[model samples]
Target: MDLECSDLFEWHMQSGHGKVYADSFALFISIPLASLCVLILIS
Candidate 1:
């Protein structure tokens, strides 16, 4: 029972880590694109 719980916790942590990494990557891509769009609009 304890082992099963630990495994589940680890799995959840891994999934959460993946989500966080993907979110940051998306933010990085979006921020640059947004900045470029804003610059184009100003120009």
Candidate 2:
């Protein structure tokens, strides 16, 4: 997961549109993932 994130970051840094897409994409993915983690911990 970390490696994938790093790769995405590197790819995004190489392009303007990719950077915007990556930032929003990361936010979208991370919110759901973080909520899942919290739910697991609460359970």
Candidate 3:
């Protein structure tokens, strides 16, 4: 199981999907946090 997980991870990094997913994930998380920060500053 561990080996399979590592293999998949390597494939993702090599294929460039890893970077895309990471960027999207960062945006997904940051957007909500940013909005919350704005709301706090306004209030």
Those runs of model 2 whose alpha carbons end farther than 4 Å from true positions after fitting are: 1-14
Candidate 3 weakest lDDT stretch, 10 residues:
8-17
What digit string (tens of lDDT, one per residue) describes model 3 on residues 1-43? 9999999877887886898976888899999999999999999
Q: Write the per-residue lDDT of candidate 1 for residues 1-43, one digit (tens) a residue.
A: 9999888767855885867766788899999999999999999
Best by TM-score: 3
- TM-scores of the models, in the order given: 0.62, 0.62, 0.67
Residue pairs with clashing backbones, model 2: none
- At residue 1, candidate 1 shows an lDDT of 100
- Ranking by lDDT, best first? 2, 3, 1
Residue 8 displacement (Å), model 1: 20
Q: Whose lDDT is higher: candidate 1's or candidate 2's?
A: 2
Q: How accurate is candidate 2 locally (lDDT)?
A: 0.90
